[model samples]
Structures are given as structure tokens and as C-alpha cells.
Target chain A: MTRRRRRLYFIVSSLTMLGVATALALNAFRENLVFFHSPSEIAEKGIPAERRFRLGGIVEENSVAQGNDGVTISFRVTDTAASVPVRHRGLLPDLFREGQGVVADGSLDKDGTFIATEILAKHDETYMPPEVAAALKKAGRWQGE
Target chain B: MANWHRLANPTLFLEWSRRVRPWTGVATAALLATGVYLSLFVAPRDYQQGDAVRIMFVHVPSAWMALFAYAVMAVASAAGLIWKSPLAHLTAKAAAPIGASFTLLALATGALWGQPMWGTWWVWDARLTSVLILFFLYLGYIALWQAIDDHARAAKSAAILALVGVVNIPIIKFSVDWWNTLHQPASVLRMDGPSIHSSLLTPLLVMGAAFAGYFVVVLSIRLEREVLARQVRTLRRVQSRG
Candidate 1:
């Protein structure tokens, strides 16, 4: 090919490749954008119990319970307006505790329990983790301290 | 455009970068000193994490600079390829090691933060994995240029590679939100506004500014050195041919 022809080929091929990659990225992004939901959102949407999602809120006071087997644990996660019961079968983060914020990644069972595969406990003096705080602010739930 | 070619003349770039070099260097030094002081001494201890949050001032800025440098390198590569400008390739080449250094800094600092808070030194989480890939991309880019003896061909191939690799940028950015990684989701770069309190925000932004200034200063130094080296190479080539 001539020099101009080669230059044209390079431009054409690179742009096409970039275009295809971008399309794929956007499609995957749309499908995979996991939106975090609060208890109040759960109440409103009635999101199917089978759908996986992130559930974030403050762990309600006096709602934590140790399982009889001694490894499993359960608690009620609250967003000041509503609460969802969550259960997990693993060691929680060092910062996990009642009255602190938490984000549990899991799917809900038919019985309305959030079966968390992973639990991230909130840290900091504020009631919310930074991500939770941002999400809360977006949802208009943040009461600035 | 022809204007792009004129702007990329090596002598012109060298002179321009040299003229601004001292200003950028002094500004970067001043900002870095102020940032370190504010971050290390002025910022209040986290109510919970205490002194550990100070790592944010370094970790966050390094990550941002890593991303920014990669972006600069990629843009330079594109400009060089599209405009047939040799100086643009040199700019991209100069940027690679700087980006790689920043990526390494971010990773090491992240590990330090993790060991104390998360109780583990490392995990093969998505966010971590993507950053690791970005670091490798920088290394590969630098290595590709070095491995090729023909500078023009090297620029062409490496520029194409850089363009192809840019897909990784968005992946690195959204990894936390897309996956349930051990890495925490973004607090500062969020749609709902930064969740960090003002006390932490102040130092973080200042450090970010310092890092950007440092990149400009360092990049100009590298670019000017490359231009000088090219002159030496050209003189040798003419002598050998004669």
C-alpha cells in the first residue's frame, strides 16, 4: 500500500476498534451497574428477593444476635426510617458493630432475609461510612453533623 | 493541522519547557511542602481510624496522579500518531516511568492502609487487580519503546498500543462499584458530592494539586532531556554517514 493508503488504514482500523470497545464497555456497564439500595428503597420497589444487590444502613441497636452454632450471625440494618434483617456466615470486619453503618453485598431470600456473602462495616465517628454517607446524601437522607 | 507540527518542533518545545521549568519546579516544591505539613500535622485525627487516615493524603493523590499521567501519555501518543510529530512520541515516552512510579506509590500506600484497617495485606479484588494491570501497562509501554531501534516505527506501534490500552482507565475507575471488592468504594469522586468531611477534604485536594504540579515539572524535565539526547543522536548519525 502507498503511504496515504497505510495512513488511512491505520486511522480506519483504530477508530473501528475503539468504537467497538466503547460499545462493549457501555453495554457491560449498563448491565453490571449494581445500584446500592436502602431499606426504604426495598420497601418501595419490592425488589425481588432473588436479585443480588448492595444493602447499606446503620446496624440497629440491640438487634444483633449470635447463632446457636456460634459462627453465624444476624442483625437488623436500619436507615433511620426502615430496616432489613441481614444474616451472614463469616467473620465480620474489625469495625463491625451495632449503631455503626454497614454495607452488605448479598441477595434476599424468599423469607425476606438478606443473606450477605460479604459484609463491610462502617468506620469513623460519623454514623455512616464515606460511601454510605455519599449515597445517603444523594438520597437526601444525610443530616449534616 | 500544520499548526500541530509547528508546535511540536523539538527546539521550540525544549525552549518552552525550559522557560517554564523553574516556575513549575518551585511551585511544585512549595505545594508539596505545604501539602505534607497540612496532611501530616494540621489535619485532625480521624475519630475512629485516628492517624491512619493521614495516609489518605498520599494514597489518594498518588492514585489520581497515576491515572492522570496515563491519560497524558495516551494523549501524547495519539497526537504523535495522528499528526506525525516526533516530539509527541518523546513526550509519551517521557511520561511512562513517571506514571509507573505513581502507580507503584499508590499500590504500596494502599497496602499499608489495608494491613491496619482491613486486617490483610493484599487481596485479588477487582479494584486491586485493575490497578495492577494499569501498572503493567505502563511498564509494557516503556519496554516496547526501548525494545525497538527504529524510532519512527516504535512510535507508531506504541501509539497504537497506548490507544488500545486506554479501555483499562474506565475499568480501573469503576471497579469498586461494579464488583464487591475488599477495596472501599469512592468517597471523594461520587455523584452525590464528596462524602469526606471538610477536614480531610482540605488536605486531600491540596495534595492532589501538589501531585499534578509535580507531574508537570517532572514531565517537562524529562521531555527537555529527551530533546537534547535526540540532538546528540542526530550529530552522531551525520558523522557516521559522512
Candidate 2:
């Protein structure tokens, strides 16, 4: 009985210690752990023009435009509070559309336009049938853009 | 205390487990058949994703089982280490490979779904990275068992590893919420209830239950083999002594 008790205490204490150490480490590296920075975060932090970083947000409605050459695309990514104009010269993902979440990798241009080297679509957790979605839209209950 | 000790006996454990093993096997087959039918034929297509949403029936269930199996292994390891229960160690050992398979399935299915939906095959986001670590932990636990010749020493070492790796479970679960991952947040499991519509949610849940039933069936079979092997080893030792 005493041995079992000792084992229990040891395991519990060690797990606690490990948990605390992990918490500390994660806290220290919190900034580095984020997969991408939102437009709002970038707007507040003001990333340097030369520093390459991923910019993520929803593609603002009616902001997508094609360049005269038809090879380049321009869109404004928005987080409701802030928006960033991004220019890309490549194929976009099939899911890329107006009012959809997107993450772009590149650096800011001299004119503050984001030059995207690559782009990825972001999916939301919501899943429903087209009819239900249409009904939600009609009812003004659809949050998904 | 007496009943607890009796329950710990490998022979008794096997006898009781045998009664339930066949039932679990049947349940797994039945549930999986119905789940597959519902997922493929009955579940409504997503408004945004269309028919591509069908992947969730398999991917979500495999991902769920991956985490569930690890939890079982961790708890059993802790019990074995604390109470000196050989059956607990065997249970943990039996679960490792099954859990690893589920983890692999989840990763593969996620990649398949991500390619067209997210436009990437893989990323080092927090949620994805943590699940990959879980797969490695399962591998490490299984390798530790094979590396040691002595059964007791092997069980002890693997138990420690299993317990230490338990920390990854919560991290994998909440990584999307805690970090800016491309992976979507929880839809089925949340404080506000499932965000997914019932048409899709029903099939996903049925598949999840089927996977759980499959785990129970496989665990029982592997555990029976482990117990028999131990008994044979002990019998040989006794004969040599005589």
C-alpha cells in the first residue's frame, strides 16, 4: 500500500512539473507559434516592408480585381477592422473567392501593397446543406461570408 | 480490495473480456455499415464544400479515435505503474498499434481533403504539428517495448513514456483555438454545442462510434494474446525449476 502511494505521488508530481515547464515554454514562444498574422495584427504591429511574413484575413467583398494583363490579381484582405491590398501573379486556389478566408505569403511593397508569392484558402467549421444556407441568408442569420 | 485483486488476475480478465469481445466485433461491423451508407447516401452535401464534405465521415472519426486510443493507453499505463497490474500494461500495449493506425489514417485523409480545399498538402501549423507528435509518441512507445528484453523493465519504461506523452493530448485538441492554424476550430465538440448541421453530424457520430467499437474488439484480441504469452512464459519457468 505504501509503495503504491509513493508511485502515485511520484507520477502526479512529475506530471505537474512537466506541465508547468511546458506552459512556460509555450508562453515564451507564443508569438512564434501563430501560423499567420491577421490584417488587424499587422496593422497594429506595422511589419517592416523588407520582412517577409504570412498575412491572413477574409477577402473583402467586391475587392477582387484582375490586372490588365489578366495574369495578375488584386484583392483586399480584411478583418472587419482593417484591410490590406494584396497583389498576386499566379494561379489561385479553387476555393479562393470574395468573402472567404485567405492566407498569403510575401512581403510588403514600397507602396504598402502586399506582394503575395503564394496563397492558401482557409475553411470555417460550419457545414450545412445549400438549402439551409440559402434560408439562413434569407433570414439574415448567415455569418459566413 | 479483494474484488479488485481478483479483477486484476489475468485469467479472470480474459474470461470476462471474452464474453464482450464478440459483441464488440459485431457492433463494429453493423455500425460501420450503417455509418458508411448514411455518410455516402443520406448526408447532405455542404453548401460551400459540396460532395467533398463526405471526407469528414472518415477523417473526423479517425482523428477522434486517434486521440481516444491515446487517452486509454495513458490511463492504463498510469494504472499499471501505480498498482502493479500486468493486465493494465498489456492493455496499454495492445492499444498502441491501433492508435498509431488511426493517427496515420487521419493524417492521410486530412492531406487529401486539404489539397483541394486549403490548396496545400501539409503545413507545420500548431494543430497539425501536435497530431504528428502524437503519431511519433505512439511509435516511440511501441519501440521502447521491443527494445527491452525483460518484460517488467520494458513495461515500466513504456509506461513512463506513455504518461509523459499524455500532455500532447490537450495540446492537439486546443491547438487551433490557441494558435492561428489553417485547420478549422472544433465544430462537433464545443461549449456551445456542435456547429455542424444535424444531417452531417449524425453520420459523423455514427462513424465515430463504429471506430470506437472496432478499437474495443481489437484491444480484446491483442490483450488475450499477451496474457497467453505471459502464462506460457511462467509455465516454462515453473517446469525448468521442477
Candidate 3:
């Protein structure tokens, strides 16, 4: 093949690869955005009934209580400025406790109780995920501790 | 300046890398020593994770390097296939194991860190799964090189696989954001300024620099060895002809 023909082939293949990469990047950006709303945001603009969404915040101090059955638990989640009461049944995550970072997925009742179907507790002390940190900051509750 | 591709020529690489080799080695040693000290001792404990956060200095850099090394290898393979350059193929071949080792380091460290934080040793999360695939792709690339005895054929086939595998790079990067998983979102790189405290960012960045520097030094050594092997093969062919 002539040098010109070989150059054309190289150009075409490189462009194809570039095109594929761009497509994947855009798809990833669009699909991966799961909006995690903090308790303050939910308080300001309410979540639709039965809308499954992620709610995260610090577990409010002195709000954690074990029911008579022991498996049922109740606590208030706070973004610092506002707190939402949450009632979760079943086993709590190993890291779940009062005054720690947490993210729960469930829906709100008309009475404004967060009935968490699934609860996720942060692993480290004073450490919440970056998303949790952002929500907390936005709610004016960030301790940065 | 556009003649930068000429650097891929084996003789040119040999001459240049020889002169710079000792400096790269010294720099790699010093930077790594300092990085280790800073990451382990000098960096303040994270308010939350405490000592476990030190793993970030090692894990994040290795994870970054694993992606970086594959990109380098893929580009080198492209050069080899496009220009029919043996030197480019050898460079790409030399880089495969290094990339694989970095991927392994990232995975192993990630598992150890995850155990305490996530309360699990492994998860089929998107980020973790994509990285596991990357590690496999590295192994496959290396295996392809050995499976084919003909140098030209082996390089041609292996280059195609490397090019195909480039799709996974973005997936690995975006996996945490794309799906709900146990892994935390990025701290250092974001549209907003890094939310991580400076105490953590300092050692992490320094370790990242040290890892990149070490890759260059090791790649140069591997490429030098590959070039020498080629010379030996050529000399034997001449002797047999004589």
C-alpha cells in the first residue's frame, strides 16, 4: 500500500476509537447520577409519596430508641439545620448508631416519618462519603469533624 | 517537536534512557522514601477512618497508575501497529506486566481497606468489577504475547486486544457514580474543590508523583532489556547465516 493509503487507515481507526471513548464517557455521566437528597432538602422540597430515594445525614443525638421488641428502632436524621424522624425495622447495619453519618433508601409518610426500607451506615468515625459531606454542608450542618 | 515519534526508535531509546537511567533510579528511590514517610507518619490521621485512611495514599495512586499504565501500553501498541515499529511493540510488551502488577496492588489494597470500611472483603459493585476486568485484560494481553511465537503476529494480535480493552478505562472511572455501591465517591478530583482535608491530600498527591516516577524508571529498565534481547536474536541469525 502507498504511504498515503496507510496514513488514511491510521487516521480512520484512531477516529473510531476516539468516537467509542466519547460515547462511553457520555453514557456513564448520564446513567450514574443518582441524586442523593439530604434531610434539609427533603424538608424544604418534599419527596413524592412512595418515591424511593436516598436520604442521608447525621443520626440526631438522643434520638435513637429501641422498641420493646428490640428489632424495631427509631431515630431522627439531621442535616444540622433540620431533622427528619426515621423509623427503620429489621437489623441495623453494624456501623449504624447515634451521631454518625448514614444514608437510607426509603420513602416518606404523609405524617413526615422516614420509613427506611434499607439503611446504610458510614464506616469510619467522623467520616461520611463525599456525597454525605456535600449534603450536610448544603444544609448548613457540616461539622467537618 | 512533531518528530517526537522518532523517540520510539530502539537505538534512540537505548542511548537516551542509558544517560537518564541513573537519575530516574535515584529520583524514584528518594521520592518513594519521602512519600512513604509522609504517608505513614507525617500525614495527620483522618478524623474518621484514622490509620485506615493511610491506605488511601497507596490505593488511590496505584489505582491511578494502573489506568495510566494501560493507556501508555495501548498507545505504544497503536504506534507499533500503525507504523510497524518493533521498538514500539517491545515497549508495549515490556509495560504489560508492570501494569498488571499495579492493578493487582490496587485490588489487594482496596480489599484490605474495604474490609474495615465496607465490612466486606469483596463486592460485585461496578467499580470493583470493572477493575477486576482490567486486571484480567492485562493478564490476557501478556498471555497473548507468549501464546504466539512469531514476533510480528504476536504483536499484531496483542495490539488489537489492548485497543479493544481501552473501553473499560472510563467504566472503571465512572463506576462509583454510575451505580449505588459500597465504594466512596472521589475526593481529590471533582468539579468542586477537593472536599478532602489538606492533611490527607498532601501525602496522597506526593505518593501519586512517586508512583508515576517509579513507573518511568522501571519501564526504561524493561525496555532496555527487551532491546538487548532483540540484538542477541539478530546476532544469532547472522551467525547462522554465516
Candidate 4:
């Protein structure tokens, strides 16, 4: 093959590959972009019934309650400005407690309570975890004190 | 200056990179220093989380670089295949290991952070799994380049591999959203703008810039080294012929 023809072949092939890869990336990110929202944002915007997303805040003190079923644990997650009730049916994290940062991934129930499919305890006081801190601070509910 | 042919010469590219390396290195160091200071000490601790948030300083940048490095490699690979430019091949070759290193750093730091917070060293969650795949892709690309005996053939094969592996980059990114995984989705580079507060964002952006600068500095230096190595080999061949 001539040099020109080879060069043309390379260009056409590479461009095709590039186009396909980029398209795949954009498509995936679009469908799966789960935004982490603070309790305050969830309060203000109101949780979308259909979209699955992450809600982050501190578990409010004395708000945790165990239902008659014994397996269902209900608690309130708050950023001080707003609070959302969270109900979980599984074992809680070792560090799970009141006044601790928690991120719950699930959707809000029709009555506005957050039904968490999975719960993660945001660890430690002196060392803030990135995602929780960023979400809280973004909502202007971050208490640095 | 406008002609693509001018950049086709490895010797010319070497000289150009040599002039740029010093500035790139300086900028990288300066940005890193500023980013570290801001992220570690200056940034306020969360009302809830105290100090562990500092890990983001390292984690976020490394993740960004991992993706950025692969993008750079893919672009260079495309250029090398299209123009058959020796400089482009070197550029792609130099970027692969560096991108891999960044991916490694991101994974390691993520594991460290995850352990303390998530109570696990590793999970087969979608995000983590996708990143693992990216790391493997980098390893495969680098290994493919090294496995081949001939330089031209190696470049061609590696370029093809890179183009193929480009599929994984998006998969790594969207895995969190697509699959029910432990890893969280992107907050910084989202369509609705960064979900992070300015106090936190300032440091994240600074660190990101530092990581980008570091990649450029290292890439240019490596590219220059590869160009010189190629020139030396060509010269040795000509002398052997004489």
C-alpha cells in the first residue's frame, strides 16, 4: 500500500474507535450519575420518588428507634438545618451512632422518609471523610465547630 | 510552524520538550505544594468528619490523573497510528506507565480511606471493580508494548490495544451509577456543577491542577528521553552501516 493510503486507513480506523469509546463513556455516565445530596437539599428540593440517590448527614441524637419487628431500625439523619428519617432493616455499622456523619443510598418514601437500602457510617471526628464533608458543606449546613 | 511535518521529526520534538520541561516541573511542584497545604491544614474540618477528609487531597487528584493519563495515551496512540509520527509513539509510550502509576495511587489511597470508613479493605462494588479493570488495562497496555520485539510493530500493536481499552475508562467512571456499588458517583465533574462547597472545592481544584501539571511535566521529560533514545539507536545503525 502507498504511504498516503496507509495514513488514510490509520486515521479512519482511529477516529472510528475514538468516536465509539467517547459515546460509550458519555452514555454510561449519563445513566449512572448518582448525586450525593445533603439532608438540607433533600428538604428544600424534596426527594424525587423515582431516582435512586445518596443522602448524607449526621444521625440525630436520641432519634434512633427500633421497631416491634426488632430487625427494623429507624433513625433521623440531620445536617442541623434539616433532618430526614431513615429506616434500615439490616445490621448497622460498628461506628453507627448519634451525631455521626452517615450516608444512606436509597429513595425517599412518599411521605418523605428516606428508606435506605444501604447505610455507611462516616468515620471519625478529627479526620473528615471527603464525600460526606463536601455534601454537607455544599448545603451550607456544615458545622465546623 | 503550522505544518504537521515539522513535528514529525523526533529530534525537533526533543528540543521543544527540553525548553518546556523546566517550566512544567516548576509549575507542578508549586501547585502541589499549594494544594497540599490547603487541603491538609487550611481547609476546615467537617462539623462531623474531622481529619480523614484530608485523604481526598491525594485520592481525588490521583483518580483524576488516572483518567487524564489514559486520555492522553489514547490521543497519542491515535496520532501515532495516523501520522506514523515517532514522537507520537514516544508520547503514548511515556504516558502509559505514568497513567498506570496514578491509577495505582488512586486505588491504594481509596482502599486506605475505605477501610477506616467502610470497614473493608476491598469490595467487589461496581466502582472499585471498574477501577480495578482500568488498572489491568494499563498493565496490559504497558505489557503489550514491552512484549513486542520491534519498536515500530510494538507501537502499532500498543496503539491498537489502547484504542480497544478505551472502552473501560467510561465503564470505570459510570460503574457506581450503573451498578449498586459501595463507591460514590462523581461530585466534582458533574453536569449541574460541583456538589462540593467552595471551601472544599478550592482545595480539590488546586490539587487537580497540581496533578495535571505533574502529568505534563513527567510526560514531557519521558517523551524527551524516548526521543533521544531513538536518535541514539538510529545513529548507531547508520555508523554500523558505514
Could you say which candidate leads in lDDT?
A: 2
Candidate 3 chain A TM is: 0.64
Model 1, B1-242: lDDT tens digits are 35665558888787788899899899889899999999998887764466888998999899999999999999999988878888888999999989999999999998888766655566555677667777767766776665556778888988887888898999889888776455677888888888677877888898999999999998998888888988998999999999
* Model 2: TM-score, first chain: 0.76
Taking all chains together, the TM-score of candidate 4 against the true structure is: 0.68
Q: Which stretches of candidate 4 lie over 4 Å from their true place?
A: A1-145, B1-4
- The single-chain TM-score for chain B of candidate 2 is 0.97
Summarize candidate 3's per-residue lDDT along A2-83 as a digit string, tens digits: 7566655554554554455445445435543333567888878978778777677788889999878878888999989899
**DockQ values, each candidate:** 0.09, 0.32, 0.09, 0.08
Worst 10 residues of 3 chain B by lDDT: B117-126
- For residue B43, what is the lDDT in candidate 1? 84
Q: Is candidate 2 or candidate 3 better by TM-score?
A: 2
Which regions of candidate 1 fall more than 4 Å away from where they truly are?
A1-60, A65-92, A99-145, B1-6
Better of 1 and 2 by lDDT: 2
lDDT of 3 at B65: 94
- lDDT, candidate 2, B1-242, per-residue tens: 35568768888989989998888899899999999999999999998888989999999999999999999999999999998888899999999999999999999999999888888988777888778778877877886676566799989999999998998899889988988988999999999989999999999999999999999999989999999999999999899999
Question: Which pairs of residues collide in model 2?
Answer: none
lDDT of 4 by residue, A15-105 (tens): 5544554554455456433335778888788657857888877789999999999999999988889888888888676557887767787
For candidate 4, lDDT tens digit of each residue in B1-242?
Answer: 23568667776777778888898889889999999999988887654435656788899899989998999999999998987777888899999889989999999999887766665567555576567667766776776665565789989999998888887788777766665455656777767777565777789889999999989988888888888888788999899999
Ordering by TM-score: 2, 1, 3, 4
